[model samples]
Every structure is written in structure tokens, then in C-alpha cells.
Target: MAVNGRSRVPTRRDLAEEELMLDTYRGRRYCKQHPSQQMIPLGVADVCPLEHSAAGEQPVDQ
Candidate 1:
């Protein structure tokens, strides 16, 4: 089977392994390191404005 750019033969073991991995994060939103925040599926590099702020800290008014 060709998915994206990778080709692999679908097997019971492969499906099982993929399911197991998905199960580990079935309901997860954010990453393990930032459990309180929402998951940024694409990435966080220069995309999240508050990425550098401390959790729960309010922004300073200009």
C-alpha cells in the first residue's frame, strides 16, 4: 500500500502496532510536556504566539 510517500505491505502485525500506538494517545489533546495546552498538529515553531509564556501568566499590557 502506498500512503503519502511510503509504501508498505499491510499486515495484521502492522495494523495491530498502529492501533496500539494510536490507543496510547486516543484522547490526548496537547503533548505530554504541555498537557494543559491544545495539540498543535502541524508544529509549534513560530506558529504559537504564546509558546514562550509561562503557563497561567497574563500578558503584559502595552
Candidate 2:
């Protein structure tokens, strides 16, 4: 299934794949512009210049 063009909540198999990917980047940070890039050292934050607008939708479980 799809949610807003992205995949829905991951299943157990999907989570296992993600875990393997995470292990490969055990000591690196992800680049916001390109999530596949993990060249930054761990604990360093990416500086995003764009400002994100707040979502107008209210919480569903409220």
C-alpha cells in the first residue's frame, strides 16, 4: 500500500532489510538531501536551509 506516494508502515521483512542497511552505516549520519548518502560522521547534524510549513490536519487519535 501507499501513503502520500511513500510506502505504508513497513512489515517484518522490510524492517529486517532496513536493519541490515543500518548496520552498514553503524557510525555514519544520513544526508537529508540524499538519504542514501551516509558520508557524514555520527552525531553530526545536517543543516537544512529550507523551512517546512506546518501540516493543517489535526491529530487523528485526539
Candidate 3:
């Protein structure tokens, strides 16, 4: 079981983080433009940066 009874299904970001051996917060993806910032995954959902800002909180129950 995952937090709030949600499944821990791995997103693209999660896989990318695992591939990079990064321990970033859940739902956060790597940012190529701003290496320091981890934004939400978008586009093909392939874990690439779409924006260069901090990844806002995921939608409720997302």
C-alpha cells in the first residue's frame, strides 16, 4: 500500500530518478535547464523538463 492508500505505481519520473540513482521526493522529475529544480513530468510523460520551475504539489489524490 502507498501513502493515503494510493498505489505506488512508478511514474516516468520515478523511473528516471531510479535510473539516475537520485533520491528526490516522490512525483518530482529532473530538470535539464535548472539542474537544481525538479519539476513535474510532462510531455510524452517521459520524465523530461517542460517548465523550469519547482514542481507544484501534485493534484489531490493524484
Which scores higher on lDDT, 2 or 3? 3
- Give me candidate 2's TM-score against the actual structure: 0.32
lDDT of each: 0.55, 0.53, 0.54
Residue 57's lDDT within candidate 3 is 38
Provide the lDDT at 44 for model 3: 47
- Show the colliding residue pairs in model 2: none
Ranking by TM-score: 2, 1, 3
Using lDDT as the measure, name the better of candidate 1 and candidate 2: 1
Candidate 2 backbone clash number: 0
Taking all chains together, the TM-score of candidate 1 against the true structure is: 0.30
Q: Which stretches of candidate 2 lie over 4 Å from their true place?
A: 1-7, 27-62
1-62 per-residue lDDT for model 1 (tens digits): 68899998999998988768866975435534444555544543312323444654554332
Query: Model 3, poorest ten-residue lDDT window?
Result: 53-62
Evaluated against the true structure, the overall lDDT of model 1 is 0.55
Off by over 4 Å in 1: 1-6, 28-62
Tell how far residue 50 is off in model 1, in angstroms.
37
Cα shift from native, residue 35, model 1 (Å): 26
N/CA/C clash count, model 1 = 0
